[model samples]
Target chain A: MAQMADKGETFPATVENRGGTGRIVLCCEHASNHFPAGWGDLGLSAEQRLAHIAWDPGALALSRRLSASLKAPLVHAPVSRLIYDLNRPPFSAGAMPARSEIHDVPGNATISAQERAARMRAIYLPFHTALHDLLAERMALGLDPVLVTVHSFTPLYFGKRREVEFGVIHDDDPSLARAIVKAAASTGLRTGLNEPYSAGDGVTHTLKLQATPYGLPHAMLEIRNDLIHDDQSVARMAELLTPVLNMGLAEIQRQAKAS
Target chain B: MAQMADKGETFPATVENRGGTGRIVLCCEHASNHFPAGWGDLGLSAEQRLAHIAWDPGALALSRRLSASLKAPLVHAPVSRLIYDLNRPPFSAGAMPARSEIHDVPGNATISAQERAARMRAIYLPFHTALHDLLAERMALGLDPVLVTVHSFTPLYFGKRREVEFGVIHDDDPSLARAIVKAAASTGLRTGLNEPYSAGDGVTHTLKLQATPYGLPHAMLEIRNDLIHDDQSVARMAELLTPVLNMGLAEIQRQAKAS
Candidate 1:
């Protein structure tokens, strides 16, 4: 019940606020970069800690901007990615990240069962529980909230340079993805279809487990990490994305109403 | 921060700890016999509240017994089924019951977005967050805890009497379901295939979200409501399930190691 920020924390793993009267609910699963005290910098140098492994650097900023512009409620996880990756299922090999690239996570290995549960209860559950509650509240009000997950993908994985400017990945709700892609292309930004990661990959959470189940109009919007590393770039991306998202949301609403 | 039950009114929900080494976790999403704190006995006499609409009457008892016998942790949501079904997705219409058999949920009509999110955040999130944390902790300790979800079904639904004595349901993990069926049949109990519900129903949560993602062995064991209505019957059901679950866990471990 203590405000995480009051403890001098950087960002709460989960935060929810009404954006506007619109029926869209925004979520950023990997939104923070601060680890709790005592994890001891994840056994990495400061520079290494700031790398993609620690957090999705630009996502939180973009999500904040989107939340402000779209006037939709935004919910995000606050703990550092190093503590526990909220996006990954708790059991995935990547969830605890025994190893990331060349860095070995000393604190993550051989964690006690109690410790694992503690972290999950502390971080993962609160974030998701908040999101679920927010969505449920929206629905109970006779409003269907379109789920928009904001994320940033590193421009490169391993050592290869990627070329996707933007990507829309989805498993079952291709309609929303298609609309976003088409809307973005109309604006001259090249979009990738499931580039960086595929929804088919079993490694997804929020979307598959939460969104798809409710048949909510949802999309996993992946912006190149390089493009969102700074505030200006993040703003630019959000600017371009606002209309696309609006278009998609409107279309989905039209379909829902017609049906 | 504060204990929910200590609030004096039982928080209208309950949390049950089925004692175990915390190696295996069990959950019953629909495990309460409640009707909003105010409905003055829910517009029906005491007999009506006792119906399946108010709670999965037989589930909590069986879940408690299973958790105790197997030394597994059990997490049950303590709200009335009529308030918000935890098993149903937050955005799904099924979440707020409009009508159930003979009685209607009077307090559930015309809820607002904020109120809906509050209920979801308050109840559903806490229950799942605990489960997620438990599983994460076990994995961190290098122990793959199997998740067993327990529930009970009425002998009839919408007006038909069910005939099966037991049901083992799974989405992609047929091996565990098959093993349980074989184990149960070996003891001469008549088991049904995905009876009462189907893995494909899109509403069942435990198996699809938790079990499937963790790649942990799981089975949704459904016993007829009448079959396990009391402690003695719950204990007997647990006695019959222990060997089957042990076998399933062993097979899962062996297969996990082999792969």
Candidate 2:
């Protein structure tokens, strides 16, 4: 067991895996707000630098806790989503956004065609390849892989306060999502079937590419960032989510075998 | 008739008109291949920097001569097409191309949504707004405006040599296009009525946004760079094109009067 999977920060997008034999794979694509210092904070003010436009604040921390709890491998992107959103496809406009909410990214204001291709090669391709390779290796080893991407959303968007605390996002597969939502409801979490963000809004790039093609049991969790901001809260949330995920996967397998 | 039109490079895209009372308006959107100094030459080698990938070579030079003879307004984008193609809409992938032919733009490789919006605000929107305002202002003054965009293409693309020396591109406007094609063919020039590129291929963002919505007589002229790579070639080509454009506009006007 390789303890951790760090493909390096130079490539921007990287993964840190706590080596485990579990079939559940946890992915945190927007895991950090660390843009390589070469970008000069992406020409953002200090306030904007720490804003949700840069990264989902508590997602990585929560995913780490869950990964540890479930004994699952976590593949994460180390660069800021402001640098390149790993959750978006190379052709997606949001993959390399020019604006998010009210803030603007000045560094990407006027780029050349050559510069675009370089980022695709350096950050985007590497991160996706690593995830794909990891999943492929597990399948080759005769282990079933369940894909789960951990995410956190802002409680407010465009000045509108969001209502749901937990969102179960999926692509064409509803078994895992429905199960997680059902269990989370029992835990008293204000759960949404696909509220806050829908998979149709082009938010499922990672899951669509990695999970749908393989027909793997997959679901992306969008927790409210405010709830998981602290370490204790993250751990507590993980504890609540771990049992749900395990049960959800067990049910999926049971149904698969029955079918 | 005013003699010259050059709006400078500070705002990047601006209108320079000779203040001619004629209905014809000239534009050279991919006019310059001059990417500003800050982006580290977009990670392109010196050779690649000067190639057609940076800008449509000879397009601006030819436009200058055409503007001189036509005595019409010429709107231009001073930044390199490699930076942000002014001929394309902000949402178009080619607007900030990550890849151009075999060359890739490193600067645009990993842009943020903020960056995309910045480019739109800084480069894309400004150019379109200026052009739109120019047309609106002319119409406001009770003057009919005929839009004409100037462009140049490579003789060889992807290792294959091309035959057409000129392409008259249009956006659903057949009157001006038919006139230009007939006039161009009469001059012993090998002309293609929308060859190498078609307006349907998303290449007519300028004409679509500026021309079609207004039902103005408009057409895009695509000259071969090999045919106008230098001062002598540019002058000769301009000399051949001037009378054709004047005659084309006259025919359009005549047809309008009859219809």
Candidate 3:
């Protein structure tokens, strides 16, 4: 990954396994908890900044393991979701949320329109544009890749505990998600289809914006953060998911060929 | 004004007083309660469709009077807010609200990504483009026009009575809003600065998105629906506010010259 030191931040977004020949294109939108130089913690305490609200803990690690296991290209954001939630479109309040869950983000409360646009220019646009270009390049190379985004959610949300371990969420098209669910049925992991969070929760924006337009099969994988807290657990989760993703891909390909 | 009946709706956005010479550009975003042919009432009853939830009552009439009174151009959305709230940026939940106040919009609950983009293309884009082109043309003609968006709110919100009849709301720059409040002081109108709804309420999206980038003086004028329920009242309200608006514009210009 190349870092632009002059931009006051690391790489806006980074690509790993760029030459991977797998039929899957991976995205990890909440990869980093970095606040950059000028943003100044977003009026958040150090603990709060490091909390799940800043970034998905271990999500980048899990995504990296998956990228290696699936031999897929991975694109990830390099700043905190507090800076700009990459999944949310520009101008949506959630894009630069003033509040998230139980915590108040004082820094985001009074952003000017010009500043909003500037954040989009510096962060959101570059990341999405890079992913779009990669997708286009893959299409040009006749890869016909399936889009799969990796994310992690906190086990306790607003003091409530979540029992679901894995979620396969879809926006409109559920082909890949269904296939993954079917493939995951053999495993002991408690997987739910459109569960924990659904498209109705506006979590599938990445799938909707990037994949639906191109008719690419897409799904968002949300792992409960407790399951992948450590490097070993992340690797184990990747090991468990890798084969299921492969089988899902195989099943979809088989169906496509049959049709 | 032009109508594209072939597209199964009226004019996506209508512009009045296109050749007006005033240095103010007025916008009525919630100008219509029209649900296009395909979107059947958004699963709302006839009464609910006609209610303020669908569109701001009497806002267009007041805007038209102001357009004539000030000899300023007016650009307005021609579809119900149920289809797409022109004031909200695309992808926002409020753009195609699943619920407004006590009403649940069954039709908008599970929109596909393609459908969302389609609505943006059909409604939001055309409206904004028309307004943007108008502003660009005005700038080209050396008229540094002020933007004034007209809207009307229900007197009762969520069963709570709102006493403020007029709200001069701003996003960041409060110059125009402050000026309007100052000018409205002489009138008997119950005016409030950023009252009823403020920038924090996400009510100033039009001003933020359309005007802020160009450094245009902008403010949103919100009138209580009870005061402008009839055409006569709308005309009278327009008459009362017309001079206030003129005085506000004069004050801003005078301040500008003094600076």
**Between 1 and 3, whose lDDT is larger?**
3
Query: Which is the leading candidate under TM-score?
Result: 1
lDDT by residue (tens digit), candidate 1, A135-245: 756665667777888888777787788888788887667778778887787767768878678776653577766676566778888888998989899889889999988
Ranking by TM-score: 1, 3, 2
Off by over 4 Å in 1: A1-11, A14-19, A35-37, A77-79, A96-99, A102-122, A200-203, A257-259, B1-13, B102-123, B156-159, B200-203, B229-232
Using Cα atoms, each model's DockQ against the true complex is 0.40, 0.01, 0.02
**lDDT for each residue of candidate 2 in B6-48, tens digit (9 for 90 to 100):** 2222344766754766788888888776766544476777888
* lDDT score of residue B217 within candidate 3: 91
Cα error of candidate 2 at position A127, Å: 0.7
Please rank every candidate by lDDT, starting with the best: 3, 2, 1
Give the per-residue lDDT digits (tens) of candidate 3, residues B1-259.
0212344332458999998899999999999999876666677899998899999999999999999999999999889988888887654778888899988888888776556655666787678767865775565344787899999999989999999999999876799899999999998999999998898888887886667645589999999999999988988899899999999999899989999
List candidate 2 stretches off by more than 4 Å: A1-13, B1-259
**For residue B127, what is the lDDT in candidate 2?**
71
Q: Give the C-alpha miss distance for residue B236 in model 1, angstroms.
A: 3.2
> How does residue B91 of candidate 1 score in lDDT?
61
Candidate with the larger DockQ of 1 and 2: 1
